[model samples]
Target chain A: MADPDSNDTVISGVAPGISRSAPQSKEEVIVISHLYKSFGSNRVLQDFNLTLYKGQNIVVLGKSGSGKSVLIKCIIGLLRPDAGEIFVFGKNVPELNHFALDELRARIGFLFQSNALYDSMTVRDNLEFPLRRHWIQVTQAQVNDMVMEALEDVGLAHTVDMMPVELSGGMRKRIALARTLILKPDIILYDEPTTGLDPITGKEIIDLIVEIQNKYNTASLIISHDMNCVRLASDLVAVLIEGKCYALDTYDRLKSSTDPNVKPFFEQ
Target chain B: MATDTTLKKFLDETGRIAVFTGRFLNEWFRPRYEISEFFRQCYIIGYKSLPLIGLTGFIIGLVMTMQLRPSMVNYGVESQIPAIVGISIIREIGPIITALIFAGKIGSSIGAELGSMKVTEQIDAMEVSGTNPFKYLVVSRVLATTFMLPVLVLLSDCIALYGSYLGVNIKGITSWSLFWNKVFTNLIYADIFPAFIKTFFFGFIVGIIGCYKGYHSSKGTEGVGRSANSSVVVSSVLIFITDLLVVQVTDLIGYG
Candidate 1:
């Protein structure tokens, strides 16, 4: 197995300034320790521990059915783990009451694998949904302004009135991204954002993910099977296999890793 | 041993249904409304189902008029045939038949769409995005169904009566004015209100059950099919159960 702390070194390469010194602050944004989750007899995640700082992009890589998506779901309080603790912004997820959970959710954003845009709603309405539901007190003009801004960021400013069905696959993903950015969430979780897209679109999506993260200075947890995306977007990489995560320093380090499972993944 | 197996199967099925229902209700009230998704659902559930409801309504009216013609003629009351068919079509048949068709089409569609989304990790996407999929998807759908179904039933009732009028005039001579007057005289506020009210419940059941089945669908292709099938069957059965209870209550209060 690769050293769990190896990925700490990779972080140094990307942001040299943040790497030079250790033990600077005690403000951990998200902390998952000893997490174990299962569906029936199938154990998907086990004893997974990770701590995320604010404004960091952590890409999770694993084969199909490796429980990478499950970890992100657990952090967002969507899927409760059978055992372990997930603390977001110093508050334990499981311990929080319903209102607290809602509050926690408001602070994070998610981009889905299939871009689960409500098929019935137009692009404009899709963006408005979260804002309205969160009761963000903005005037109609402000809402319109924000929606346009978000759409512009994704290069879909002209698609405001169009429905998801009318958009191509790449366009739908952009619209989903625009919707994700509408709330200006502090934390963003993406599940297979580049999956099923052409390589050009996939690269474009990866660039957008990086651009968005940098723009908002937000923490991101991305789950993907594409190694290229994992390498491009990650400040830290965690390879999940057999319900356990082997944290790595970088894609290069993971590729060169001597772990039997890690070797085959790179060779392929 | 066989009896015990049957009992166990019953308990297991009931438990699954109960859990599904509970989760749906829990998610239904939580904040986050998907207005676009809801409107899309309304288009499918309300507008799309109109053609089927209309066809069935027309057939129901035509058949009732034709069947009642002979019985009324034997009693020298052939002139009363239009009124009898009109009352039956509006008061009872229109709402129930429309609801059943709505359940078959809209209920199953909601169930399958949501179910597939759940299995495919789309719902999870909403949660991570700080959006409540439940409020956005489920509540809006339930609300749309609640309001739209009553309107559909009302439309179906009107169309059905027109169909009946046409059927009555095929062989016998009756003025449109006299036909409507007779139909309206036999009709009371009592009959219209209860029937209309029941449709809202029918819509609620269809929306809730379809959502419930889809939301809890297991992660696979098979889960989608199961969700769609269960939604139609369960909603259809619930509509009948609710109708029976409503009818009995109305009768007890002397509305019948």
Candidate 2:
């Protein structure tokens, strides 16, 4: 069992099975070690290790089907890892009971790949969803205020009553970001945030992500195949290949590195 | 070779049905509620299904009355046409046919919508948000279907009785007052209550199975089609199974 209160500090003491040294300074918020997962015969993740610190934007770069989404899904408990451990906020994810897992989840936000906005809900209703579910004691005025504030944060305040279908792809992404912000989470996970947008809109989304992270001081883990996004959004970059992380470094360092496999991906 | 193929098909169908039922039961009690999503599902699963159910009920009544009239006339029981068709429609035909129609329309929609949501990672978004997607998606749908099916069945029964009257008057002289008098006179509480009661379960099965298929659907467009097809097929089959049990129980309790 892992202590829920000391979730951030526990990751530094645990290594990725073979390494004994800590990956970061004392401010680490997530630590994953020897994590393994499989779906039928497909082994998606194998003995993967990662450590994310507070306010760090860790971009996971991988080709499609390289299990970047699975890694995040495991951390969020949507998909269970076969072996090893995940500690978020110092709580070992697998050991935490359902109640604790839920409590932990409430403090985290996720921006889905497709924006995942409920097609049936208006933008206002979509933003209101998490608030209403978890914060029942909040007054209607407070809910309204918060929803508007979140929408304003994403610059979609005027599209409150519009359904998801009515919005452009970029607007939908912003609306999703607004929905993520409504929870006031300490951490936000983005799955391919700019996969389908025009380059200009994609850049705008990247800037919005940075803005949100800086303003909220929320740690972000972004999974994307978009190299430009990886270059712009990452404080540290991890390239996932062959079920394990090959490199975790700054953009300039990874770009200049002589490692054969890591070099081609960064160069391209 | 033919027997082997048939056996394999039977096993496949059986396995699918079991999995569908099991998943629905499992997801029913799971926590997490998406209220806005649920209401939207209700509108789709319940409200939108009305026109189709209504139309089917009307046709069933008209056809049933027309078919039975000449036979009753041959037996010199022409006066019993409305009474017989009315009892048949209210007691069984109306609820069952409407439910089958409901299963086809609403069940398929719930399946496809949820399937697409699952594929697109929307359900995943809800789960990661600390919201219980199961409670929000599955339970709300089940609740809506449970409540709405009865209303739909009642409306269907009423519309069907009207259609039966129209059929009765097509070839013969019958006043609306006298026609209804004959129909209602034979229909006791026993004939109506059991039939009405069964529809709630019918709705529950349809909603639960449709939602179960959609919510657990695999990734991509292909999964969406599988969900829709399974929802209709499974719900239609369950309606029959449920109708059979309801009939047996009604018989055991001496409803006839």
**Stretches of candidate 2 exceeding 4 Å from the true structure:** A1-25, B1-44, B188-190, B248-256
Q: Among these predicted structures, which one has the highest DockQ? A: 2
Docking quality level of the chain pair in candidate 2: medium
Off by over 4 Å in 1: A1-27, B1-11, B18-55, B116-122, B129-132, B147-151, B184-201, B218-222, B241-256
lDDT of 1 by residue, B1-256 (tens): 9999999987987798678568767766654446676787687678987888888888888788988898899999998887788778777889889999999888988899899888767777656545567786778888788888998999888888888888898888788899899899888888788888888899999888898888889958898999999999989998999999999999999886
Clash pairs detected, candidate 1: A7-A248, A7-A249, A110-B128, A110-B129, B32-B136, B33-B136, B34-B136
Weakest 10 consecutive residues, lDDT, candidate 1 chain B?
Answer: B28-37
What are the DockQ scores of the candidates, in order?
Answer: 0.47, 0.63
- Candidate 1 clash total? 7
Question: Going through the candidates in order, what is the number of backbone clashes in each?
Answer: 7, 7
Query: Model 1 chain A, poorest ten-residue lDDT window?
Result: A15-24
A168-239: candidate 2 lDDT, tens digit per residue: 999999999999899899889999999899999998998888777768778889998778788777777787
Error of 2 at A4 (Å): 32
Residues A1-268 of candidate 1 have per-residue lDDT tens digits of 5554554222333332222222223356888899999999999998888877777777888889999888887887888899999989989997877668878887888888878887767999889977876668999999999999999999999999999899999999999999889989888889899999999999999888888876888888899888778778877677777787665456666667766767766676
Query: Best candidate per TM-score, number?
Result: 2
